[model samples]
Target chain A: MSTATPVTAGADTAAVRQAIATTARPPRPGPLSTALTFGWRGMLKVKHVPEQLLDVTVTPVMFLLMFTYLFGGAIAGSTSAYLDYTLPGLLVMSVLFTTVYSGVSLNTDLTKGVVDRFRSLPIWRPAPLLGSLLGDSVRYVIAGTVIIVVGVALGYRPDAGVTGALGALALVVVFSFGLSWVFSVLGLLLRSPNAVMNAGFMGIFPLTFLSNVFVDPATLPGPLEAFVNVNPISILATACRSLMDGTPDGEAITTSLVVAAALAAIFLPITTRLYRSR
Target chain B: MTTHAPLAIEVTGLEKSFGDTHAVAGVDLAVPEGSIYGVLGPNGAGKTTVIRMLATLIPPDAGTARVLGHDIRTEGDAVRSLVSLTGQLASVDEELTGRENLILLGRLLGLSRSASRTRADELLEAFGISEAAARLVKHYSGGMRRRLDIAASIVVTPRLMFLDEPTTGLDPRSRGQVWEIARALQAGGTTILLCTQYLEEADQLADGIAVIDRGKVIAEGTPGQLKASVGTGGLKVRLLDPGQRGDAAGILERAVGAVVLDADPAALSVSSADASRAADGVSALARAGLGIAEFSLGQPSLDEVFLALTGHLAEERDATLEEQSS
Candidate 1:
């Protein structure tokens, strides 16, 4: 007998199996409690497999460092001045790119049947999906914080104090939350993880780069400029800029919020319904 | 507990479809309380599909079921509360250490943090993986991972368990270990619904067995009854001399009072309704001076039973999938 044998042998197997019926039923926890349990489990994933944090943490650090020095002087005349402009867009890009993870992790769970046990449990059926979305949002917040702190360190200053910086971060985090549903849809629709990543690359690039995130819309050709001026990514960067520069643009902020809300209203149902039907 | 036990599982006309293919056409089952029921089938025979419906993982398109006397359709929560499932794919988190997996399961079941930790420790020790409790399950061997998975399911010691191919991919030794665990669970008064492609597994473990093919229950009975339905136990005889084959066949058939199913050049076999008729054949052969190389009586092979119940051999899978997919 091994060390584990005695503990198991001491229990009466029949009594234990029947004990579920004899004992008082444990009160069922709310969906939030169940969801957070899974959310906490998701957070631990970045701990055990630290590589999962690369997209959120290391990418922000690397992008802020690279884009600030290389494109800064060329675009804005001085590296320090360019840091002010590029930092906002770079923050948006880093957080936006981190949304790819929601899709990847969700696809991994559904395809590998990782949540199969959760599906059979007595807990709220939607908890895993809700938890997964929340867990990914937490990752986005971490990425956003990294971008802003690194941006500040690189001579980029926000005219808006802590309050404005917090507001800007909140808006971006909510936008990232909505954008995650799109990737979540892709995660469910596509079977291959590689396909999900490729789709993210193809879809996210044109939206983020074609926008005025990196350069002024006034510097672009007429057609490209028109697209950039109306791009949702551009609206997001503009809102964050106004908030950070202490000159808030009400229309930009409203439009960005509206777009994020629309994305969530449409895709959230589709993702949840597809998930439940499975 | 009531003096009169209810059927642990009862269903009627369960149906489900994926696209044009009917994954489970229409299934009905009644499993006795505290008895092991086996659903035996080949790949794509809808064993997993039926189990999923019963386990409440997927809703059936039509029909209904009551598990532990609770309707699966309307009272899925009640049904789920009582039944635990170890799915075809081991559903434990690969990223979590074994201890974390158990703790998470406990927390979901409403155990407090300290209680969950205590329960997790108990389960780990019970499953004999206490030493590896802190190790990530991805690093565990196939046997250790599955043991821990089963251990996790018993966190509250569910009264009814659905084991969907609990030993599908393990080696013989690991398979034996899993079998022991399943037996222990059953001995603890758990009603088990076991689905497997391994006929030997069902035969050894299940008190009653159902042979499913193309999403339908083609045959259902005790293993003995099913095996007997395939035309009785078989009697095989091999002679030392090939020339004596015909003579041996006649003497044995006359001695055993059965028709010879096959007569090869040097060997002969017959259906023995009374498997013990081999004893009669032995004396008759000795009396006839025919040197017997071998003589044995055995029940029909499960494959033969499957072949008898369904037209094709059990291993030959459904060709309809290709037709439906195309």
Candidate 2:
């Protein structure tokens, strides 16, 4: 074929030269911008691999349906009444459960070569960690909204209505954001994504279940009840329940916020340190 | 020997260790600006470790390196701003499309929304990955992923580029394409630090090569000087008549230093350090009235040089390293 040219011909060489000849580099991006860009990457991952959403979305929906139907009448004398009590708790459970994936995805990034690319860039060090948690907050919102919508469809009605539900979701999202830092630490410390996944679920499962999400702390033994009352998940769930009940518990809300803040304070630095050293 | 040639990378007494396995012992390198400097080594020869330390991905236990005149440790921000790394594995995000990967990097590099998209498209087109730009990178072939990886690195036209085994797992055609791209980058004045295990790759593209073994540079020179250091240029002759090979071997040993008969029975090769001696051996064969079907003289390949320097074949160490690492 006369049309064929040499591999390193004029066209290819010219193109490569033009691509890499720019002497002027754009000013380095600020930490917030780089973090947001990484968040965009996380969102794109969700868009491409929608299956990852099944854990956060479908699992919670299943829990909402199964818990309400299986023990609704036995626990609260009726399914509709049980939905009112369990809906807010389920929102907290769903969102917190979704936080585990933040670690899974972070570990996945570490295993892949892409983390090296990100590390070598001139961007902020914690941008990937913070930005991915930001993206995962979206997943938390999805999980919370799905459970609330599904509960409402199953005859749940909050005393404070839509505004109350939205407030509760915001609170739950903030808590999940803090909790995600713990998993980000796990993701960095662990060697494999599967190990991070297993460890994350193992830690989160007991914390969520041992709390008042599925049952009242009053129903447990004295020591178990004490553990449940002190559980941060239980306090968060209490704040969410009060918000949806139109009677905001000031003490419960303050404690949950403080606990979430403390998690961020302690784990964020640890996660960043592990990320840098690993 | 341009004494004043500005070095793109200057490493001194660089050291790193992973527990007991001293990945990089004391080593040094001076890479000239705009040159393709090859770090030729087998697997686990501390090649990746050295590049990682220089790229600021990991800290060295002891050492100081200046990349583009900025200290890799203290002035890391400056070095990062001017350089990029294409790691041993394709470093682009696998979940994102080819276009998205470039756009993401462009955005991270401070381009505006529209500008990042424009630059991404330009790179996708330049790298000949425009057709698969919309497809997820996980679906791309090895060559396409490598091109996209390189495109992502140059989103802002880095002053220095670190290519860690860029053609490691690629097919021959893809490897050639990568070499072409690398040469084109060099033409545009990008100083490339290429790491590879394949001797031919270094021989083909490296203007200067550092032969690294056991976490240290055993030798550093142009490919010619390295081959010459081994001191054996082979002269192989294939005869028309198999019976004359015995007489030819005697003539070659007399003129050259040593001769080894080939398995083909009609062929024999002589090892000579001097080009004049090789030519004299050829003439001596002709004078003896021995039939000479064909004969050629060439320097010892880098494979031979690596073996003579390391006491083991490059591939032999590679197999052991691969097994241990995996």
Question: Which candidate achieves the best lDDT against the true structure?
Answer: 2
lDDT of 1 by residue, A51-81 (tens): 7777567866776777668887888898888
Q: Lowest summed-lDDT stretch of 10 residues in model 1 chain A?
A: A7-16
* Model 2 native-contact share: 0.70
Query: Where does candidate 2 stray beyond 4 Å?
Result: A1-11, B231-303, B315-326
How far is B218's C-alpha from truth in model 1 (Å)?
Answer: 1.2
| Tens digit per residue, CA lDDT, model 2, B1-326 | 56477999999999987766777888899999989999988788888889888999888899889999999889888888889999888898999999999999999989989999999988888888888989999999888899999999899888899999999888888899899989988888889999998777887899999999878999999987877777757788899899998899898888886676666899887644467888899899999999899988866554556657776655533434321221
With a 3 Å backbone cut-off (N, CA, C), the pairs that clash in candidate 2 are: none
> In model 1, where do residues sit more than 4 Å from their true spots?
A1-24, B1-4, B231-302, B316-326
TM-score (0 to 1) for chain B of model 1: 0.78
Looking at model 2 chain A, which ten-residue stretch has the lowest summed lDDT? A5-14
